[model samples]
Target chain A: MNGKYRILLPVLSLTVLLAAVFYLQPRAMSYFGLNLLFNLAVPIALATIAQMMIIMVNDIDLSVGTFVSFVACVTATFLNDAPLIGVAILLASILAYAAIGALIHIRQLPAIVVTLGMSFVWGGLAVLLLPSPGGAAPAWIRTVMTVKPPLVPMAVVACILIAGLTHLLIMRSSTGTLLRAVGGNAQAVARSGWSVTKLKAGAYALAGVFGVLAGVCLVGLTTSADANIALRYTLLSIAGVILGGGEFTGGRVSPVGAVLGALTLALAGSFLSFMRLSPDWQIGAQGAILILVLAVRLIFSRRGRKWKGAENG
Target chain B: MNTKAKLLGAAALVAVTLPGHAVADTADKRIALSNNYAGNSWRQAMLESWAKVGDKAVEDGVVAAADAFTTSENQATEQAAQIQNMILQGYDAIVVNAASPTALNGAIKEACDAGITVVSFDGIVTEPCAWRIAVDFKEMGRQQVEYLAGRLPDGGNLLEIRGLAGVFVDDEIHAGIEEGVAEFPKFKIVGSVHGDWAQDVAQKAVAGVLPSLPEISGVVTQGGDGYGAAQAIKAAGRDMPIIVMGNRQDEMKWWAEARDENGYETLSLSIAPGVGTLALWVAQQVLDGAEVPKDLTVPFLKVTQDTLDETLAATPEGSVANVEYSQEDAKSVIAAAK
Candidate 1:
């Protein structure tokens, strides 16, 4: 419910996670351990924070997966020292994403419908841009991804910088507070003298910015970006948001939680692969973990409601 | 929407035109070889060779052309759609590198039934109706293991990193390896792993099994992904003298001639590029109404440092090995056959 209690959740969780990591040791350190976990955290952290930004305005932007994947592929293929063209493309793609958000808000379409349609369009355009996966990312740009400087992964640094910047922006501006208010009660916020549509679009623009960052992370981790990469993360990012307690209805899903979820999944994969357990079981187990975590939350919420009601009476 | 539909609709119209053209004159027609997608270098070489051969066809009007339909990869459904479009566009014959060979049966049959010939290369379709062009992958595996066993004649352990599982390539290679190893008593396979033909995953798969595979005399893998196995072996500082990969003639030439700057001796041989080429020829021949036998096995070269030949250096890029035919030679062969 509060800081210490929230800290306990991850702290206790990491202990169990670390214990399992040691248990699975053939070399006493698995590929999915701290370093890899931190790497996994980078993309999920950026994306979840981005998603949370949109959610804070009670709007959803489903095209972020497409955004990141498209940006990564384009960056790999087109983000060159042409200097002028690269800047234009980056600005264009961001504006395109923001424009999609604005249109949906203006039309008053359900975020689910508009964003879902936007995903198909964004993904279609990505495929059209780079039909195959031959292109290479710029050497200097990709250099940030492949190495760990000063014992910290480039991904970890990227993640921390993104998180810190996001924190600073939202904390410094009234826009962040307005967005949260809109999420809690859109009608009330609009009545209280704010342009709800603009606020909602700003939230989505933040998601777009985060999507661009995720694309950068992708280029670093996987030196190549293809059409297939974007398709997989569509659902994975959503899962990250929900798993990190980022409400679909617009609430804070801690960036840390999203990173942890990604790390846990990657570690689970590494563990199963190490054991020579067939990948089938690995997939089934991951799905089961998701369902189990959600079910536990569902049960706890019911109990929480009952306890609160009893105390109030 | 109307403009887009009209353009696509017109393209579709032309694709269906091949069948009618074929009916009027099968003896000499502009034959188009329409294919789904060129996703990899293997398929790239396959298609490029087909196009070159088509260009070199003897009869002036009886030309061969290759029309690449889509750039998308691994989308079987899109691939099937392309096939249907080819049929409608009236390509007199098709050389299919099916995404899922089995899933392609219905469409392949539709084209064949309409008198537009269809033959599959690279990926063998489930349909028995279409001829499979390529090497006996089974024999290639056998040959691979046999070569390794001969090198380590006293019989030693092997770490086998396989390709994408469940596909035709893996299945045939696995079967061939098993068959070949059965004959060699000294050969004991230590570990078999799947890397899904992904370089990084294969590298890790090799790393994971390396420590336990101390007795390993050789490492064998699906050729394209073999670099991954080789990288892992090098990183581990294990000098397992035998390593094999997919045979691109150009690369094989490099391997045979490669002077090591990093100080590891280069032991290289040409695997078989001929398999995919042979498959292409078989498809060509069958579509041309030539009676091919039940199946054919494209040959493999087992070169060591001892057998390194400068003859390989003379072999031209994009030219098929042992295809000695010139324009006149092709005409003579066709005339004699006729």
Candidate 2:
């Protein structure tokens, strides 16, 4: 399959979705309207990227949502009240993620089970940190998140920067190639004098960094954190990665695609609510759209592979 | 047949509570407050109120010890386990804000069989053996909508900011709003969104729909979303409509300021966080051999421009709108319930 085509497909679909929403509510095309619609997309995109990093190493992070939520709880409580302890805790949590990666590599355990177990642990810890949701986010963080730039929505600018930076790190760097190779063919990468476990651990650490950022951004927007605030992100992040041309195996992912996918889903909710559809059907509608996008991606990728095969033949 | 069973059930509960009644004069009685979910300010306020009242009771020799347990997961099974542990610890009474209406019935019945008094509030349980203390959230919703209906006499577009979807309180309140709207021919609900009972979420939701909605004359919101709705309206640079304020301190402040500045007249109502204190008093009463009723209905606190200043002054910083009730007031509520 053509590399450019893979990127174009999801981007094109996102454009179409955005256009439809803009057409339905013309006022949504404005900067303020878009800001309102995409205000919550930054954290979701970060979480999706975090999940994408795990997928890049052929491991799924079931705990990303809870981990992000835990970070949010920390951000609202200790981060606001006691900066030194909060920073230490945040750094420690990242280290813990790295350790989880090492543990999975050492034990040869399924990543799903380990992360699922960790989700409970992270959730419990978050509850302990902030039993109820009343804490405030740091003033600077809130200001950064709520800032409205001159032309485009602040969320769009943030997404562009996130995708650009992640793209450079994961798609353009040497370590990125090795990380993908670790998932693609670990034995071959190992035989080539690279430590597969180290690369995998690096991917998990990167995932942790993104998860922390996601939590911080979420707290900035929410101004308060509850243990279950981002519980839905577990599935949403997975869906965003898949919708953004990420695969379950072989460590295939696109940072730009993932951000666009997050934006698409966030806008879908706003679009539906703007249309005043019944809340009961809104969730079903979101599912239908997600399935439709995935199905289209499946068909396109399959056809692209067939065309490539024909050319090779 | 159902009526007869209910009567027998009531008699059985009375018989069960009678033992505690007999032992009311005991020097010390341990009480545990078990909450299913402690993820919101309301729950926090309830717990704080319990601590305040419970500590006073402890000092007064009304309770030997007062302990609070909460499940962060909001899981019914977790709450049930907590209740079981409370019973095992030989608590004289267990006050619960149930996670589920029916999930704790069996555990409550177990506590009941073990001669423990169970009092469930807010998200109450269905176990006939347990006493329920709560406000009519549905009626509150109805009244909010009715007030908006009165404002929009000719029937205008109303943006409805609902509470968390699939929640029992949300469902009841939504149903009541629907019923209230049915009574008012002029009221039209043009747009509805789930605020999840949070200010930020509510503001975002209202902002999203405001672009597509034709001029909304009023916004009917469940408590916690009222101030957010107003903020969304203000942010949109649209004319402020009749927004019913919630019980939040921020809402009271906004209401007072808006009224003083522009004479903005809107009704605000909320199930006070002090209800937990009422439950505490009721627990003390029950343990004191007062024969408290099996069920008690607390009224929602209403705030108008006239009452906004007082409400704001009464509520502490960062707290929700509330009404303080004394032990005598709780006794009156108990008597009224009977």
The true-versus-predicted C-alpha distance at residue A8 of model 1, in Å, is 5.2
Which residues of candidate 2, in runs, are more than 4 Å off? Answer: B1-338
Docking class of 1: incorrect
lDDT of 1 by residue, A1-313 (tens): 2222323333344455556656655343432223443453466567666666766666666776776777776776777546467667878777776776677778887887888888887788778877755355677765666565766556456656765566566645576667777777888888988887787777777788878777766655545556645444555666665655456664554555555454454444444433434333545776776676566555655666787789899
TM-score, one value per model: 0.48, 0.52
What does the lDDT read for residue A276 in candidate 2? 45
Interface residue Cα RMSD of candidate 1 after superposition: 17.3
Which residue pairs of candidate 2 clash? B155-B186, B247-B321
Residue A179 of model 2 has an lDDT of 88
TM-score of chain A as modeled in candidate 2: 0.97
Query: Which sections of candidate 1 miss by over 4 Å?
Result: A1-15, A26-33, A167-173, A250-252, A299-313, B1-338
